[model samples]
Target: MSKSVVPVNIADKLSQFSELWSQKKVAVLNDYEVKLAKLKGEFVWHTHEDTDELFLVISGRLTIQLRDADVVLEPGELYVVPRGVEHCPVADEETAILLLEPAGTINTGDAGGPMTKAAEILN
Candidate 1:
């Protein structure tokens, strides 16, 4: 039998991954990965074919642009974009965010542009 321990400080776990765009994975269950991302500037417009993505602003503001709508999220705010919806993230300043999505979800989706990054998790 195997048992897992709950983390004491999510913020500390997040601090472990300081690299840009590299996610820090806190936990995984079935198909979902709980991750933390530190972001700045603009990310490529992309979409996932298999699952929706949830973005929660943890400590800074983030702006998300959908095909037709522009949403700004502040600390304690969250949004979910349905699968197959194209969207881009732009942060004028450094921001920290939490993400919930299916495992194997790509950051750039089907459109691998210049901004496409090979996903990596910080240990």
Candidate 2:
């Protein structure tokens, strides 16, 4: 891991990317990674069998569509989708989010397709 004691500026880091649905790595905590992502529209319905996925809304609104319920999140709010549960995230407009999960967790989870991207570390 890159050594740095300075605090990460979320807004400054978020400004480095413009692509939607792509997760950019910001920090690492033991075996977990802290990520930032820009999301819009609805994501694929998927399940992370080995890890729980956390989504913290930074801007705009997000709706986590589960098999039987929907979790709505606004800025400064967060939700955790438990392991093995199928979920689809939706955003009506451009939304910025913080994600926390085990290292190497795929964005698309078990439903791998075109949107399965390995999170890139942001320098």
Candidate 3:
């Protein structure tokens, strides 16, 4: 069997940040990056005009509000918001999630508001 480069504990990385909506890169594969973030409350409404976003819930609840419908994700669940789709994510309580996307995807996508965080931060 092939061995992993190393084990990454999602919970351990999640504990490295206390602020909500901040993401930390945990791993990389080719052109994609694996990230972990702590989320709560509603994120800014935005769209990745050039790329899609994948959200995997590690714990707690995540509600992705889409233009036409809302998707609720639970632990072990995942959702991919297609490119150019405007959506908002809200967490009634603190939630932990993993994201898979192109290496340079900004957290706020096209919004780029004050909440937009640099994508290079790693754990």
Candidate 4:
């Protein structure tokens, strides 16, 4: 197998889409997919039973609402939601984030609704 040596610009890939809550797969590492999403408003309360979900703020702010407390993240910050933990992501304004999860992990997790979107490769 041949792999090309290339760099993926996060800003460039983010510029390719404007739809909120939609995930764009930018790269893959091992079995995990590196994804980017433009988020606004609130996301569904969900839980990935078998895998932890990583949310890395690229721009703006994100609040992960947990039953006990809220985890607030700003640009350059990240938080890992443990498996089986229900969390709802809320953004007061337009925010860009990077998500790291296993391949084929559903955006909505256990809470499947209209907000759920299958991640598509940015390329």
Candidate 5:
């Protein structure tokens, strides 16, 4: 078997990708993948049927919109969107975020709309 070394400094690795909304995967194990994302503007309103998504703000602010409420997360703050709960994400300015979710969780969820990303943000 070939052996390879995985590097440290996930944040530094994440910085290599400059595309907006594209998620750079830092690590993965079994059924989950840890990712870093740069977010701006508005994301589609949607929900995951089988998994909850964790969002941790690394820099700037992250706003999560629910049916009747909106939660704003600042740096060092974190939020989890429960499975099957509809939500949208918006950032007035550039924001850096970390996310943990099942490997196949879809960003657009079941509700596909104009804002749905045609491609999965993977690197």
Candidate 6:
């Protein structure tokens, strides 16, 4: 059963999953979906052609490499990668990140490769 309304504890919810580089859906608001992911090492280079992607770091460090620079994010830092921008994320160690994106936005984006996952709703 779903509650009419409640609170979302990002840190607590993030601790429920351990899969690296896979996004787990936690909730939805209007057309946006709230998700969490644990990442490690390097991820595939890709781009979202339709919508921008938002990344808010919850733990460790994540570096998003763009064509011109690498954006490093620590806990509490957030970045919004505009649609159609090519990029790759690298994590030297375990890092948890919160994502706010449009519902049905695939993790691997336009480049959809081996790491692509169909985000699953988490109870």
- Give the Cα error of residue 48 in candidate 2, in Å: 0.4
Give residue 57's error in model 3 in angstroms.
0.4
Model 4, 8-102: lDDT tens digits are 99999998999999999999999999999999999999999999999999999999999999999999999999999999999999999999999
lDDT of each: 0.83, 0.97, 0.89, 0.96, 0.81, 0.90
Model 1, which residues run further than 4 Å from truth? Answer: none
Give all TM-scores, in the order shown. Answer: 0.89, 0.97, 0.92, 0.98, 0.84, 0.94
- In terms of lDDT, which candidate is strongest? 2
In the range 39-90, model 3's lDDT, one tens digit per residue, is: 9899999999999899999999999999999999999999999999999999
lDDT of 5 by residue, 1-123 (tens): 654476547568657777777666776756887888889999888889899999999888999999989999999999999998999989898999988998866668898765455334443
lDDT accuracy of residue 36 in candidate 6: 90
After superposition of all CA atoms, the RMSD between model 2 and the true structure is 1.3
Error of 1 at 72 (Å): 0.7
Separate clash counts for every candidate: 0, 0, 0, 0, 0, 0
Worst 10 residues of 5 by lDDT: 114-123
Q: Which candidate would rank higher by TM-score, 3 or 6? A: 6
Which residues of candidate 4, in runs, are more than 4 Å off? none
Pick out the ten consecutive residues of candidate 1 with the lowest summed lDDT. Answer: 114-123
Query: What are the runs in model 2 whose C-alpha is more than 4 Å off?
Result: none
